[model samples]
Target: MGQVDPHRPPWVFDCKLTARTTPNPEKFDEALRQHVGRPGHWIDLEVRGDCSDAELELIRRLAQEADTRPVVVRHVAKLISAGQEEAGHDEPS
Candidate 1:
């Protein structure tokens, strides 16, 4: 882990997902159709900094609406750290 920068704010994280049907192959396409492609179904979302209350609510609703369970999600963010540079601590060649 890197040292946190006192002067900067914590970075926000985001994610986008495209998920298909069930674990079973026979219902895979159908599940995707019902969960992703159908009207009133949500296919993707952007999660920010652990997500906002509204966003979290939407995600929960989407999960229920799609009749799906969330396993894992990938996140992207900018990492910032403040520390002494160690480049100079080296032996002479």
Candidate 2:
């Protein structure tokens, strides 16, 4: 895990979502691809505290609406971690 910066704003907990709600499995897969692959299609969301009530509700709704099993959802934490790693590579020895 990377060090959490104390000075950074609380937006760090903010997550990005990828969703699909087609009526069939095949079309749902395509929707997932379109939302996950394209930029801006993913929405930025924040959990006020450690956990987010609204986010959970949205996830539940998405799961219920998904046409296929295992509704996929990705968060921004991984992205932030990757960026941190990239930046760390340039740090002074």
lDDT of each: 0.45, 0.44
Clashing residue pairs in candidate 2 are none
Tens-place lDDT digits, model 2, residues 22-92: 45656434654554443543343322223355676675456435433434343332224323432224566
Which candidate ranks first by TM-score, i.e. highest?
2
**CA-RMSD of model 2:** 13.2
Q: Candidate 1, residues 15-88: lDDT per residue as tens digits?
A: 33333436664543455455455444334543434455676675556445555544222233323233222333
TM-score of candidate 1 on Cα atoms, chains taken together: 0.24
10 residues in a row with least lDDT, candidate 1: 78-87
- Choose the strongest candidate by lDDT: 1
